[model samples]
Target: MDTTTAPDRDDWITTPLTAALLRGALELERTGHGLLPHRLPARARAQCTDPQLAMVESQPSGVRLVFRTRATAVELDTLPTKRNYTGAPPRPDGVYELLVDGRPAGRGSVTGGNTLTIDMETWASDYRPGEPGTVRFDGLPGRAKTVEIWLPHNETTELVALRTDAPVEAVAERGRVWLHHGSSISHGSEAAGPTSIWPALAASLGGVGLVNLGLGGSALLDPFTARAMRDTPADLISVKIGINLVNLDLMRLRAFGPAVHGFLDTIRDGHPATPLLVVSPILCPIHEDTPGPGAPDLEALSTGRVRFVATGDPAERAAGKLTLGVIREELARIVRERAADDPHLHHLDGRELYGPADHERLPLPDNLHPDAATHRLIGERFATAVFGEGGAFAEGGTSSPSAD
Candidate 1:
């Protein structure tokens, strides 16, 4: 484990956490105690009143603070909102990943902050406030280098202070910006750490900066979300659609097609020619053929393990209910049709990233989200499929592949 200690206050230099020093967040909100990073702008956030959307957008999956300093020791004070299920096992502390000059250097975790407790059976929640905690790292080389502190992907953190042994200056970012939006899976659920999330991992591998707008359980083709994506500047963009819609049973097939079209249309209004890829859902056995309104498996929950089961009937498909299979087919056709006029449009079958074979080796722990190993696999595959040679976002690459 990385070491944490209370260093001499007089020896430390404090820096203000400003927008320039941060990456992958669309907005920074001032709180009573500190600053909080948000993935959606104020306009979009005001359009939705859902608490789940509000919470996940503030999680900061790809948000990190970057600066150049010669400090051997660094400390950041943060107030994190940690979630807990009423009956489920306690979750591990959220990790703060430190990277020096773009290489992993150390990892640390804060001890105390705020807590959000949820009743799994009743779906009610309680919030308890706590004092801020410091995440400290020491024993550096003391040579001038770029430092990046990646915030925890699953926790909503308020940045209170940044203290270093030496003066720090903001470092300007380089490389292409890849903006991606998807469901909870893309939001980094079940991943071990912030940077370990598939999108962050893929961004590093692809040599691109990432702006992840993956709203957990809220990527249901919301107009506000599409508008947010439209306004955010990015060179490469992708939207992973399906799982959330299926699991929530939010819409029927009739609404699904037009919703996707409008979502893409909204994005194109701002980024008319940016390389955009549409990804279908990965191979999820439960929702592949069956429709869903997924429900928690009470039997597994009783055993201190959380699992999900699909509740929608396959017979509902006759009434135009959506399933993963139907979604994949519709997405492919839509991309193909749009690619004819919109040359920059492309599509990638999510199964190519996580198919049956991969699932057999590493099944989803909750029968919904991928495990850590699966996240790495998906990230590697995504980097190759979208950012590799002849891929959609590759330099000089033109024409969208219908399926890859």
Candidate 2:
């Protein structure tokens, strides 16, 4: 802790950070290098073996630095580790969205931090740690205002320090907190920017706070993740299921039903009456009828990109293999059964956000995740379906004891 809020212009005042400003992240650890934010709490993280979960959770997809300041100029030093798949296009610099007074103000980018490159062909990995970089912003309103710096949603960001011309203080938020969990699609897979991700966009449109647990390739309905959701304080909750299960072929229909029940039960243990929405998968033709064990299209990778393909046979569904269509039907049935005694439980067909018709116009570029425009479309649909007037989960809106 620095006692000096010494503000004289050129002297960069170091602002102290607290729990109030950091959103989405579960905990902040002060390391010798800087402050690292973890999406899953220590206990939860300790129970997971999959490295993919570890990566996406720490990426800080919906995390940002929020504070109130009158400084005309500000600088945030951070080290961002961008994920890269071998034989794929290199990702652009992580974007920093600077919002002032709840409005788009400016933007910044930090380059040269670190890269975690994976060779999907060989399942080998390489890590390169780079130097810390700074994202500087100037030309502010020069008046005390709430400012939010949304970090890169697709990269793991380690915040180094905050330097502002004036002292900074955390602002108390005023909105219902929405805790959301889903797969990579919800993790802003192909979204345009950090804030442009569907969840972030929906939160902005719905006038609510978002704690996105959209772990890419990691939303496996793990008990620990459910615990994370249970412990977190939230007024609204949603879990998008299906794609990850189909892609990983983690379990059969018999196991899927019980897992979903257990997931909801754990959350209800902490939040018995919070409005809970269970959403199924959107239209992914490859996985809709076919089972998976999704695999990367080697041909597409040779062209310097990553594309996914369903490898399992549709007929295999007869033997208890999971498919998007199968998961959707099961989720709806489970939600309906549970709602008999739990009036707060609700169900949503993910297709309602992006169905077959929408797929024709806005196709999933990689045949797995929606592209940028689709992200916007899905976000808009979710805002209307869940938060609009008379919507099921809308604040103070009508509550139905059945799936919609």
Candidate 3:
């Protein structure tokens, strides 16, 4: 039998977990139930009835709790909202990773959480609430050290309470905060783990603090999202555009241009000179030329595997519809024109991270998102291109094209 008791404040400092210490999550909502990590703020989430957005925002893909601690054993109470598939293989439990002083330490998972079951054809879902789960890690070095608890990238987490054998304090963040917004790929897609995701990996390699706003299937150029980014405190910012716009068929080229401009304009209103990088979509052959309202490959689905197929016709390009190729060109033009006036803005071709030849070497398993290996590849490539010597975001992030 295990005997554990909550320690007094003097024995363990209990700080109200706030957004300041969280990474990857965009916003934090303090519900009466707990602190819910949200990819979209209350204002943004309130405006949407889309099930996909709701699910994506709630899934704290790269979210984590970091602090300096002297405790050997630590515990956190969390309410995790897990998704349940109707006919697919039983989904695995969301994982929690513990790192001590920048080294891998231990891992755990919370059990008996709420589940949301969705029907593929109807695009409908039913939510069932369950009790919260407690995550515990022990057997660390008894001396003071930095401790990071990585939240599940695929689960919506409501932080309840934190307790440790000894005192814990927020770590003094060392580098600039890198605020990033992107699609499912940035939300971790099918990455092996939360911190192992590309953005997380890149942040680690680049020596930057991370605030990942990677909302899966929901990275459309929404004004609210741009406003959210504008309001957030960040030393550096990046927007990975195109994939969601292409896959959702949400906007044509005509609307996309203004929307991209508007999105950048909103961010600039608050951070006019902050280094902002605009990244176009990586190579996805299906959506390279074919336009989309992408559909699930029914043949693969029947075999308990998920795959995507572009449904829009290539001939629709004349109609101003969007494809990755069209998006890349427009993004380049937007950044070039804007950079003439806004010297702090820069653009990077996403293909530089994952291009055609690289695609041939490491193909996306689902025909959409990158596999675990590809995520690693993208992360390494991004770190080298944007964080290495003389890169776009290299020194202090003041490097942008000279204004015309």
lDDT score for residue 327 of model 2: 94
Q: What is the lDDT of candidate 1?
A: 0.91
Q: What tens digits encode model 2's per-residue C-alpha lDDT throughout 1-404?
A: 12334356568798766677787788887866688888889898888867788888888888988898888878888988977889898878878898887788888889898889999888678999888999988878777898999888888888898899888988776789999999999999988788899999999999998899999998899999999999999999999999999999999988999999999999999999999999999999999999999999999999997889999998999999999999999999999999999988888999999999998899889899999999999999999988887666687754785554
Best by lDDT: 1
For candidate 3, the 10 contiguous residues with the lowest summed lDDT are 1-10
* Candidate 2: Cα lDDT at 116: 93
Candidates in order, TM-scores: namely: 0.97, 0.96, 0.93
lDDT of candidate 1 over 78-152, digit per residue (tens):
999998888799988899999988888989998779999888778789999999999987877678889999999
lDDT of 3 by residue, 1-404 (tens): 12344455367645678866676676778876789988778888888888898888888876788888768788888988888766666778888998887777888889987888886656778999999889888777877788899998988888988888877777767778899999999999888888889998998899888888898998999898999999988988999999999888998888999999999999999998888999999999999999999988878888888788999999999999999999999999999999989888988899999999998999999899998899999999999988887676797546655221
Error of 3 at 169 (Å): 1.9
Residue 67 in candidate 3 has what lDDT? 88
Sequence-dependent TM-score of model 2:
0.96
| Candidate 3: clashing pairs of residues | 24-212, 61-153
Candidate 3 lDDT at 69 equals 70
